[model samples]
Target: MTTISAGATDPISPGVRHVKRPTPLRESVYEALTEMIIDGTLERGRHLVEVELAGMLGVSRQPVREALQRLNNEGWVDLRPGFGAMVHVPAEDEVDQLLAARAALESESARLAARHATKDDVARLKELCKVGTAYHEAGDIDGAVRTNGELHSLITQMSGNRFLVDFAAQVDRRVRWYYTPVAPVRGAASWREHNRLVKAIEVGDEDKAAQTMREHTEHTRKAYHDLQAGSTAEPATDPDPAPRTRRRRTT
Candidate 1:
């Protein structure tokens, strides 16, 4: 004897589609403000005035206030009792932890992508790589950073693990935030590394893909630290005795 659940195996849905719902004003405002922060439009430690933001975004002050409160809870903004709201400057430990988590997740994504990526997926990655390379070569740091995020996201999608994708999504925006400033420093070399990663996935070499991704992420991490060090270091009046040549990047 066997039991069958109702609607079980209800002929596989005909097409891939998702229902759409209208977003709440507060949520939309939150997302918009978050983007402004992530892309450096808002800048670290920038004061967030409700009325000004509302006017800029063509929204009411209430939603802006709500969004700021939410951002404060999420550590994206600092809301002082009487001083008002300002973007929270990320501490060194915060950036390191987030980037470390990203490295682990993306390295695994590269491994899984090598195992699961279809021919079409590889082709698409190649196309994106070409576009990213063009952006890098043109000295368009914003375009390159945007494409870099896309390429990594595509690799995670190719992993075919929904859980991994969800986890990656959590850190993706912050990663973009940290990456934006270093994009110019990474230059064309970053795209060249991406090409290597794509080739590994295309060949279905899981170990190689994982290793490549790990090294690639490490380079970015190091570059970020280097940039931060340079920013904080006192200006030198004397020429450096050891001026190391920087490796050029593509995207």
Candidate 2:
């Protein structure tokens, strides 16, 4: 029996060995880091160190730095002069403004979709709803958020208006950052509302679709407010133990 070379692992080829190609560092880093920020894994106010992130992602510092800069430009991170980059935390008012804008854009999108959506568009909406419901049931809140966004995106595209589609896409990204963190707690009710919205679109009911879209966004805003209030009302815990008074040892 002939002995195989050390690098030859594949049975089909005598000399050819499987080679693992290195994934492009910047592309991988961008997606991995962005997903963490979007899903709240990175968390607000958390500082990002390029070295640490690069090491974690199995990449070099250059890619991490580039990714951070891109994130900063997108409002996902803030780079300070003295301190390193920190996750951008939206203020309450900022969140409110985002939701208000989403309400207006999406309401119009729903109306246009109701008027122009073909049978295929309605079927696609139903499929998206089913996928979103499955993800919600599985406790995969992030998955639900992504699929739900797709449903809305499809409707906006089917509206046959390019300008409205572009505006809605930009606003939707901000809406997603808020929704993903809060969805698991409100998944059930949200999915039910999505089903109702889908039905309205399917029947070509413009008024009903627009109204439902507005109400849906309003419900999300209410949930966000309640969550914020509950968090603020919770008692804060001291990180350190209380200091005890020292007794005199040399009396």
Output the number of the TM-score-best candidate: 1
Q: Give the per-residue lDDT of model 2 (tens digit) for 144-190.
A: 88998898899889878899998987887778888875676456666
Per-candidate RMSD, Å = 8.2, 14.0
Candidate 1 lDDT over residue span 1-251, tens digit each: 86679877645578867679899999999999999998889999898899999998999999999999999998899999999999999887898899889999999999999999999999999999999888877767678889999999999999999999999999999899988877877666677789989999999999999999998887787777877777422223212222323333323
lDDT of 2 at 40: 81
Candidate 2 whole-model C-alpha lDDT, 0 to 1? 0.80
Give candidate 2 misplaced runs (Cα > 4 Å): 1-28, 231-251
Model 1: runs farther than 4 Å from truth? 1-21, 231-251
Ten contiguous residues minimizing lDDT sum, candidate 1:
232-241
